[model samples]
Target chain A: MSRYLAAVVLLAGLAHPAVGAAQAAQNATLRRAQQAYDNLEYRQVLTLARAALRERLTGAERARAYELLGFTYGAMDSILKAVDAFKQVVLLDPERQLDPNRVSPKAYSAFDVALRQVLLVRQLRVDSVSFVGGQGAVPVRFTVTQPARVVARAIGSGATVVIDSGAWNGQVNLRWPARLPGGDPVPAGTYTLVVDARLGQNTFSASQPIRVSHGRVDTLPSVTSLPGYQFLPETEIPPQSWRPVGLAFLYTGGALVGTLGLESSSLGSSSKRELGLVGGAALVTGFVMMLRKPAARPAQANILYNHLLRDQIARRNQDIAKENVARRQQVQVTVAPVSPVTPK
Target chain B: MTRAALGPLLLALALRPAAGQLVAVGPQFVLADYREVASGLRYRGNGFGGALWARRNRFSVEAAVVRLSFDPVAGSAADSGFTATQVDAWVAYDVAAYASIEVGVLHRSVDPEFDAQSVGALRVGARSFYQIGPGATVVFRANYLAAPKFSGGGHAAVSLDLGLGLDVRLAGRLHGTATYAFNRMNRRTNPGGTGEIDAPIQETVARLGLALGF
Candidate 1:
């Protein structure tokens, strides 16, 4: 009985080796698939990989099978199927890499496409907002997965201005003139900068807000102080139909007439002479007045007006500060690159 | 009024209805000091006046009239003062946001013909402005004035006007304007002309006014 038991144990060990051999044989399908892909027998590689996937393979083995399937499909120009297979490879072992020496450039490029299709990521950035001369412009930057059509629009309170529209590829940098198509400065207000990119049937868009400040028009009472003067000085007043010299001439003529009247029968010679002297004095005074200009008073009013103006300026500065705060609140600018939205 | 005097008023009225035009009118306070070499007299006074300014795009017209009374000076036997009026029109071309070059015509008159002075001139100038704060600007201007025998005396003169000014917003379309200017008038002596006895004059003017926009 002991001899029989020893022989049976040896047979059991042999049976264990047979089971291991069967498992090894089953794993060989993935290895064969890899070899087939190397030999350029893409159809055979697909068949072997499919069979290996059907069985319960180890994680590493499953990844290798998927990689082989992807390469085979790519070689056959079956891009979508190859992409689908490559996705599986990544799912199994994300750290896998196809050897550059062994893989064709086209296959690698197709794999890249597959990766982007599976995880779409794109971004748009508003590089800057600036002005040239009096014309304003904005700079935009974006990365493209492929060739695409790009359009930018600046929307303002009363108008929608299209800044850019064209086909582009790769990394794109564009400068958009901040005026309407008609080449007029946009009216002042808050504006939205929107960028849209179309890649085949996919569309992506982003927006940011900016402020355009032309000078503001105000309509308040004047801050300048009024002068306290019964009448403006001759030097400071505007031209008039009547002048001081003319009045002087009239006064002198009236004095001469009074002297003449005194010279007539009713007045004594002494009175007449006195009247004549008065007329002569009046004439001389009028002539002097005509020759001499009228001087003005001191400029106290101007000093007061300037003081008021300075106060107004200080107050306006405060108002501007408040306006700046409000403008900051209105301007919602985002410059960070954003993750791409999945296509519907 | 003479045609020359009426021309500016008519132009302002016409432009008042136009779009993008600004018209401002207000009372002004003025302080001025003047020195005449021939008379060896120094005249100084303060006065009130009115100013009108019309602006459209790069073009502008400004007019001001003031009356000034002088203190009794030793050289003159009588008190001397005069009403002065000025009108100017200019077009400005901007080279930068804060600077501009301008060319214009100016007309000036002094009542009672003090020293037989004439004021018509061709003006060339430059102006610069800086925004120190919101609704406020500090402005500087310099101009070369060439008068080519505009006075009947057949005497030509050249002058310079240097100005510093400030504009402060008061309310909607209303602003306060304050300016200080220095003027140097150099008269050319005609060899045997009776009016040639006058000497160069240096004047300083300070003005403050309210400006309104239409």
Candidate 2:
């Protein structure tokens, strides 16, 4: 009996060590999953956590495994699977809560969505925008998990104005009447849409960019048409003058007077009178005609108008180009719930 | 007076319109001198005339007619003088803007009651103009006149004349013109014979007028 007891003791000691090594290998899989998660190896965490949950595990160990699965799925953008994993964690340990700081709000919100599967909340996004007068109001659509105080703020450069706010529930569509709180038409430019939904102590917010656009966004001050007279260029030739003709006639009369004087000594009274009359009349007529001159007429003014018109057309094209760039640079943003929610 | 008549007819032909044409008409006064060598008589006269001139591109036409009565010196008989009528017509080709060559005719006749002489001649002439202003021009003309014999014992006469003229614009299409001319004529009587046939005469005339154009 002593010899048989000694052999069994030695065999039991060896079996105990072998059994510990097998259990240690199983525990190491869970530990390795946690280390992979910490190292941000999400694919490895998904594989190790799934394998650990398939095996027999304590409640705490199972909850930890599901937590790892939740974060891994969330990192991979599989929100439904993440929600399912987190919900399993809650079902396993009702007293445990997810640390808000450690996970993103998206993950927390998804978890809340799974917790309250009866009421679904969707992501906020712009629904539509209209630019015509009386239809300028922008519509924002969103679905809520429950009734909540929803506030939409339109933020602009140094100017924050609440565009819409009210108590609302279910799939709600809000209209931001295209005006500031001061009842002024919104100036054309860029703006930000901030949607805040508050239910009990929980508050959620979303930010989106919005813009207002119009064909005539800028005020074009009245452009006066160019004056016709200003564009006329000076001509090289001076206007016609009749002064030389008058001077010539005057000189001719002087010569005639001198001729009559030379002929007076030899002429009879009648002859002398005839010469005097002819020469005197010529002198008088010349003096009179010398004073008369015609007025100069103006040149054609339309030539200048043609040049100015071309320049004005070019400027107008540039103005149109500037307006086009301004219009295209505008982006209209509307914020509302766009994605449909489903329980995983 | 066939040549005299033809002068006006050719002038009328040169009136054919081309790119541009000018027409002028005017009242005129003429101072005339008359001398007779055989009689040793001298006279002076005054007359009135109408002048017409037209130009079409490089061509031109002109016509004038004057009537005058000469007065004798003191102690001279009333029958020693005569009343005369003169007509002139011409056609010219402008070789340049300011120069032209012309052909014309002149007819000078006395009233039968005055028992005076009648003469007809064909004329060839050259004229030059200097433009001083718009519508103002100074003119110089020289010509030779070939006169045919019309009386028994009379031979053909040749005459030369130098004329100075002025064209003064009064207003639109209205103008005044004045001219002074010196003429010398030589006549032969009884060709191939001689009996005081080489008669030379000198005449001077001054004219003033106003013209209208269309």
TM-score of chain A of each: 0.31, 0.34
Cα lDDT of model 2 by residue, A1-344, tens digit: 99989645543332231232233444667777777766667789889989998888887678777877776677678999988987787556533455555456656666676655423234455654555333357776666556778887877774677867788776677777666556555666666777677877766565666765444334344344544524454233334454444544544444444344333222222233333444344444444444544323334555556566768866876787776676555434332333332112
TM-score of each: 0.34, 0.40
In candidate 2, stretches whose alpha carbon ends up further than 4 angstroms from where it belongs are: A1-344, B1-21, B26-29, B75-78, B113-115, B131-136, B147-158, B169-174, B190-193
Model number with the top TM-score? 2
Interface root mean square deviation per prediction: 23.7, 5.8
Which residue pairs collide in model 2, if any?
A: A124-A336, A125-A335, A125-A336, A126-A334, A141-A337, A210-A333, A211-A332, A211-A333, B25-B211, B26-B210
Per-residue accuracy of model 1 over B26-142 as CA lDDT, tens digit each = 777776665544444555566777777776666555666666554534654346655556555556666676787888766656666753355677878887755433344555667
Could you give candidate 2's per-residue lDDT for residues B40-62 as a string of tens digits?
45666779998999888889998
TM-score for the B chain of model 2 = 0.80
Model 1 C-alpha lDDT per residue in residues A257-285, reported as the tens digit of each score:
43333221211121223223333433343
